[model samples]
Target chain A: MAALLETLTEDQRDALKELMNIAMGQAADRLARLIDTLVILSVPSIRLATECAPDLSDCPIFSAPSAYITRQSFLGALRGEVLVCFEQDGADELASLMGFDENLNTDEHDELMLDVTNILSSACIKGLAEQLELPASFGAPSILATNSTLFDKVGDVINRDQTLILEICFKVESHSFTCDLLVCVARESLPSVIEAINRMLEDL
Target chain B: MAPLSDLLRAVIDELNMGVMIVDPELRLELWNRFMAMHSCRTEEDVQGRVLFDVFPDLPEKWFRQKVRSVLELQTLAFTSWVQRPHVFDFAGSRPITGKQSKMYQDTTFFPILEHGNVTHVGILIADATERAVQHQIMHDLNQRLSQEKVEQQHLIEKLEEAQNQLLQSEKMAAIGQLAAGVAHEINNPIGYVYSNIGSLERSAQDLLDMVRAWREAVEASGAPELVEKLDDLAKKYDFDFIQEDLSDLIAESREGAERVKRIVQDLKDFSHVDKAEWQLADLHKGLDSTLNVVWNEVKYKAEVIKEYGNLPEVECIASQLNQVFMNLIVNAAHAIEERGTITIRTGCKGDEVFVSVSDTGCGIPEQNLTKLFEPFFTTKPVGKGTGLGLSLSYSIVQRHQGRIEVESEVGRGTTFTVWLPIRQPEKQVDE
Candidate 1:
């Protein structure tokens, strides 16, 4: 696992980061359109590993005391899953943003979170797949954990080895709304992604 | 043999689930046998028609969005009966028992790709009525179980309260019986001792008078030798001291006997455990008897003052009222830190009589006043009080259709007043 990152040359890593930034930028735009607010998306970070566990010390979401996490899987030529991490009060923030403060019960809050997860994951995966020129399809997004930042849940959901993790952060301007999106590419499909990255590098 | 295409077509028609294909505009391109059998629309009847047009009950807006997403993302989309009970309102699969009138459906939408571009969407529907019914039954059972759990907890609390009350009352009854028995036994011995003292006092007075008269006669006779001898005997016998102390000794003995008799009478009146029925009784007598019964508890800590007023006979269980009075007096005595005063005041207004016991002891805090009558609520140290004293008193007063009111100021002292009607209502008199 430690040597997994050494396999990617500096050029390949940079190329992957650039692609992720574009993909995450598209996802942030979709969210902005959905909530009718400006969204700030940071530059995406890329990490590759041969096991499910990845060192998450530098990641703000994983290091936080607690978080609300949801997961969505995409299948076909591009296969992996995305984990959308929100702060503890993320439901209130999103509910206020969408003007759903009236009668937003617990079940409704979970539904809203899953809906947002679906939108963000599908949009982000679609963008990434478009750039790589591969077909991707999505499974339904579900709540993996709520008000918790336990890595065990993340590890259980992303059990495949030889994984590539793409990380990005989203912030709503002038609001306390922020979330992190961690996209994990599956083991069997890592070679295709690497091959695509190499092809992009050669073009560059 | 039939061609492979013909055989496949027949196989698709014979499948159990409802299978349909629709174009991008939701125009039905294919409908299977199950769809035709449920909707009562043959393929020829609904061919090339918009799906929503044939089935107006369908959630058109949501279905449209689901199909659009599946087409746009080229991904398989699904819905469970739990989330959406039915995509199409078909009759339930169970016809014999008729437990369900509406079918539950778990539907799925997937894109049909040709040459890598999506052209149509396929829909599959499966009957989920049995699973939905089972889940509903389980949920209802769980709700009832929790409700029973809560009721059981409440019943257990009630049983514990009743048991505690029985224990306290039983212990009190036994003590009352013992005190009455001891008072009865002491009454016999004290009665004889009192009469004997009365007879002795009269006899001694008569003898002394007679002796004095004789001595005067002897002196008049003027016998010098005899006079000298009498004087020597008197001096030797200390006759002056004997004459002075005899009356004093007799008086003290009478007073002691009277006190013992009064105490025995008070004990008999205070218990009345044998006569537990309600009667028209004097509250003053009950109060005095209760005071005497608890005097030992009060002597060291408090000085008691009785401020009595004329009151009508109150209809009540006399023994229970005495118990209440005893509890109040003892509690008043216990409240005093050093030496203080406990005052008993009685009065009448209208048809009600009131007796208030006031103490000059450290008063109860304002916050504790409300919970004073609650069972097991006490400020006294463990074993010093069962905390049932005031609660029992309150209930006894309530049983006579009376109420107890309390007033207190911290460090100033507290007063508890009980008020009862002069006569119980007619219905209670029957009981």
Candidate 2:
């Protein structure tokens, strides 16, 4: 697992984390403004995608059995999929904040999930693209599963070897909504991403 | 000569989708022909106006935030038809399905960047009503298919129940035929053996008396030697004890044969082969006969108690009613593990006669109460029950235009009460 992370130089790893921190901050800010609540974001962590497989007991999102997962794909200079996992308890608060009734049917829950995923994924991807000067387009966000195994739902999509994963966590201060965002970049896309980051570094 | 900018404007005007641009202050900078057709306003009227003012129904707060995010992050933003149905209320062009009364739209906001600073936010809207209608149709079809699947499952369950009831009745009919044949075959030999035992006892008494008289005559003829010899022979053969024991042996044998005859008779009565047609009969008599038939099964498990009521002669097929009594009594006996009482009570309620069989044993659970009469539903261990006893009993009562009711409690007891009218209705008989 360490060998996979060793593929990136110390400077590249620090740059990727810094870029993710800025992107996730923008996502948190947008969600806060939309819901009129304060949002807190954690420092993003960069690791090998295979190291994040759910079989690891320490994996945060997978360890929580009751998590709602949403997924979207991005295409541009760097490409892979983005996964947002929301705790089940947090989903209720999020739904209520969106002006939905306390008892949400399946369709209402699905709509709420898609709406949140769209807000966060778009903001995060857009933030990254703007910083890297890379034009990226995001596919429509969709709910993958509710109250199900996160690994089983996303295992096939993220199964490629030597993929890099960036994990970010966020919380709504006044509400109970907390979630984890995982951005997985294809191994082939890493070199292009590194070049873009170095170009921005020289410009800075 | 026309400038290249004028030709670009001409091409934008010919496009099908709506186009608009908003500046940093959220004022509309440009509107295109598609927007003019849908919004009922042209570029001359809406340009330089606030976008919300032009379309009052637009979600002002949400749209402002979207445009702000585009300008602030310099990143593209999107909203699907599902998130918000339409930003502009364009009337429906195809109203056949009436699913969409207004045009469904997918919108995107992109920042127009110049010199690394956002200058304007350009908005594009595409009609999505056709796709929305197709999705609605598919969702409706899926819901209907699931409903049909549920109904089909219920129908299959009902068919299975009917088949089980048919099978149980067929099994009972075959058993009844076999019982009747065996009873008839056993009756003949038992009849003659019972008669011969009675006659043998009387004939033995007469022969013993004749032998004693002849011995007295020989002794009185003064043949002393001959008399002594005869006395020795009688003592050696034990003639006196044989004369005394022979009569008792014949009497006991006669009694045993009588019991065998009675058991065969009870079997015949239970099968009702001799009388199938409906007739007026005493319920108590039928109850006693059923008790005799099932005594061996009940004797060791539980004691039987009878509570008789002044019941009228019910018009029913006696043999079928006997069968019902046998099933209930046997079920009650099976319910009692040991040292419990099976109470068989009968009484009259207006024009109806009721029989109740109750057991002081483990009672049924509340969840299983409703399923008690369903075919193939049993709590007994495998092979201990066929799970068709109660179901068959239920159908038999229904056939006679009667009803059976039960009350039970866990670890306390269970009671099955059957009610039948004294007179069968003519319509019921025809059916």
Candidate 3:
């Protein structure tokens, strides 16, 4: 990300970072309302990178096997897609939270896990829409790979350093949530995004 | 009131729905021919009267507001059980199809807006009697389908269980065959050993007889010397009764071994590995053997009072019925913890033979009585009850085209009456 940072002008980086700071706060507020909790948000730190390239193993949403990996492409000047995960331990916790006995049958457990993912992902998208000031609507997020299937397909494609990710943390009602906001550009949308931010800054 | 209008009025009157139209002041304007038939009120007296005065029993404020909302919104359609619970009984379609021609229980209230605003209201009431009956039929069909599906699943499970039992029985049969052969071989040796023991006893007896003869001969010829010698011999070895008891001890040991052989045969026959399907069986025979097996439990705890009446041979799955008997007998024993009585009576009732087992023990509580036939429900303490005894018996009896009923009072006793047809009745769920 530091090496990627050198590609962008100083003004562009500052604008992007400031934009991220506002976006993360908006995301947190949306979550706080729905769950009915006073959620405190930390401003996201923006970094210019071609890809998030997060440690695949660190993503608790996927098992080492049969995990579906999907990539969503949002079309616009400066568009980024989020990575949502489904993990086994997370499923166990989620099923318990849904008031299901831990000894639920396999299909019941699967349904509970599906509901949890749906709620979290939809909530996060609502937050993103609030921040971008863009008329944000979502298409269905597809499952890309199951288990470690993404690791092999994404092996060398994620090395780009020009992409930037704004990562934010939300603390609400004893639940800690981490939302990743990625802003990817094709060198063209980067300018538009910057201009939008400038117009925002001028208004501010 | 022309002839054409009269014809239309007659047609409307014959229709099933109750249609009533009211004017601006909420006075009934068109209490149609249909309303006259259902509400048992004619248009003449009901017209020009307030709806409240007509149907005074209608529930309160919110309902009036809902009517106003209908007039305000111009439409409303939803089932409302809130007004009263037995809503279905009030003559409305259960599941309406927007058709009010039939005797259905669905109701709809409509607002007639003349100028994009409410002017009058029409209430359409349809008799839901047929719809309710249809709904019940569909519901019963659904329940039967669900029950059949469950029974199908259980049948599959039962098949698997029976297959496993068959395999277990096969293994035991093989062991029994081997045991029968081995026992045959062992018997040959036993017979020889037994005969040899008998011969040895006889030889010992002969040596004793010879010794006795010599002693007697000596005593007769004798005099004081011989008599003194006989007395010394008697004192040296007290051989008084050894000759009389040795043979009896040897004979008893042989008889004990024969008893063991009979028990092994009974067990092998009980498993019945060679045959799988049910056969006609004598209930008395099955009951006697089952009683013998459970005797120890019942002997000290409860004296079994058996009154076996004349009964025809019953066609059934004998082993399963035996299992039912075993459960009931053991249950009776358990009920009578210390010295009580279990009275078992069998009699023919119509085309069925009824067996009733009554125990004078701690009876079931009324609260737990209904659930006694429910699977996995038990009043017995944990580890002491499987909760399957009565339920299993119930299933078995049902499978036999039979029914099981229990009557009991707390602290009094429990009596289980099972009725079985003389012939196999048509298959129910078990098939």
Task: Point out where model 3 deviates above 4 Å.
Answer: A1-204, B1-237, B243-262, B274-277, B280-282, B310-314, B347-355, B422-431
True contacts kept of 3: 0.00
TM-score of each: 0.64, 0.76, 0.42
The residue-by-residue lDDT of candidate 1 on A1-204, one tens digit each, is: 334445778888888888877777776665666556787777556766432235643345455655678888899989999888877665566655543444666655665566556656776788789778888887877777876673656644443455788776767766767778888888777777878889999897
Encode model 2's per-residue lDDT on B161-181: one tens digit a residue: 678867865676677778879
> Which model scores highest in TM-score?
2
Q: TM-score for model 1?
A: 0.64
Query: For residues B1-431, could you state the per-residue lDDT of candidate 3 as single tens digits?
Result: 11238777677667766666766456887766666655667788887988778777553332354355345434432222211222122333334653333343445566686666778776766554665656658989999999999999999977764555455445545764675566566666666776776787678778888988988888788688888888788767766656556667766765755544444444433444444356877888778767865677789998888999999998887766776787798998898767899999999988999888999999988888778876667767899976666777787788788999899987789999889998885564246
What local lDDT does model 1 show for residue B352?
Answer: 94
Poorest 10 consecutive residues by lDDT, candidate 2 chain A: A53-62
Descending-DockQ candidate ranking: 2, 1, 3
Candidate 1 lDDT at A19 equals 83
Model 1 DockQ vs. reference: 0.15
Consecutive 10-residue window with the lowest summed lDDT within model 1 chain B? B1-10
lDDT of 1 at B37: 90
